[model samples]
Target: MTKRQQLEMDRGQDGSDSVHPLHNVSSDRSLTVYPRGDGQLVVETETLGHLTPRRTHGTDEGRTDAKLPDRPSVHGLSPDLLVPQPATLEPLDQHIRSHTGYPDIIYQATLIPPANFAMVAPFVYRSSFPLKKNFPFLLKLGIKSILTLILEDYPVQNVKFLRENGIRLFQFGVPGNKEPFVDIPQDMIAAALATLLDRRNHPILIHCNKGKHRTGCLVGCLRRLQHWSLTAIFEEYRTFSAPKSRHMDQQFIELFNMAHVGPLIDTNHLPPWPTLL
Candidate 1:
């Protein structure tokens, strides 16, 4: 065929001329083909645009090589493709421990008669020993005295911390067991109530090991002094002492004579209950 006819036949429908059949076309570059006596086409590709080499600056030297960002293997693909990266998820216990620093002590604690009580209510609070790390939380409450129902001696460090913070301690040992027939003594309960009644120890904290049983009994008696119904007092006790509530403690709270404790700080003149910030 004549060169002109061959060229016309090779031209695409869009009127753009195509290279010889043996040559390949590129999206961004032009292709040229030359026929040889062997009937094979020699192909040459030319880039469509001019590219300027990028220049970089260096701190020590005058000039530096251009640095390019790392690219993924499969253009447009993520670099982490097929790579088994470790998970960065935190465990549930670890998350809680990060905040509390004490994983074992998960019991909830709050001010007695809750903050919802009227402002005239006494400023009494209850919780487990303000263990070293938790002392700051207790200190912020401005507690003046601590009433411990624990039978064992107080932790020396806790006592020292209380003294350093100008907090007096009153201990009335009640056996820390759940024996159904075991009862809290009336005299001890009376004395504890008397201490609670005195305005000198206005902001008091009563606690046992877990702040459940012994503390519940003492608070139950105080609730009795406040003329709270047996149902209300028991409900409050059961709330703190949950799944492991002691029947004997409830029985003691029910049978305990409010007359033994005598008159307490009149409900009308009590200080406002403190709250957590």
Candidate 2:
């Protein structure tokens, strides 16, 4: 091909172009292509009905991942049960442990609700006392073990830390910034549960700072997953956190109803929802 032809192909202006990074790109936008020789790249636009989005989305906007290096124990307490802050909700930490910090508790409440599929909880939120310590006690006291979590850029360190100390974690990453949000693949959560040796344990805990928005969304997902009624969820979470984390409860309820279907997510202990409409 001539140099001019090659340039046109690279610009995605020629009909004959095969591997332009942004296929059918607009003139004002250009995409740099680094192929398998570097890193394969492509871009494309989709129509939303008759309206064009006329907007850009992030490439790795709200990505959450595994692992972190263990940090020094905060407060005067040992690295046992801690309440990382930005949490305005009731102090479950005083009941569970003695230490606390604000921005330090990344995704602290990620245990699943009596199911194994929500292991991301411990990983996303690192703490000293494992949720395992609280589960049996909660159950003996007649509270259903339920935890809801939401976090961002959650570390794998939390996951490894919780596991080393005999705790199960559950985290679902929804990528975005601020109130305007987009979802990353939380389906990997179900995959995490499938790998666990046991699936029917209880006294699960889930958290996000303040145990409000993200925690709420997760409880909603779990309620739908286990076929529990919204009323049951509100009550269960209230029982665990005591004074009741109602904002979390309601937020989760909104998210659950958003799906408009009953496909169960906690497939480890609960059978899959029948996909009912």
Best by lDDT: 1
Query: Per-model C-alpha lDDT, please?
Result: 0.63, 0.39
Error of 1 at 53 (Å): 15
Q: What's the true lDDT of residue 83 in model 2?
A: 29
lDDT of 2 by residue, 43-129 (tens): 223344231222222342222211122436545443333322233334564433333343435446543333222332322221122
lDDT of 1 by residue, 41-126 (tens): 33444565633222222331111222223434543323333221235236655544553456454644432432112212457777
- List candidate 1 segments past 4 Å from native: 1-121, 263-277
RMSD of 2: 28.3
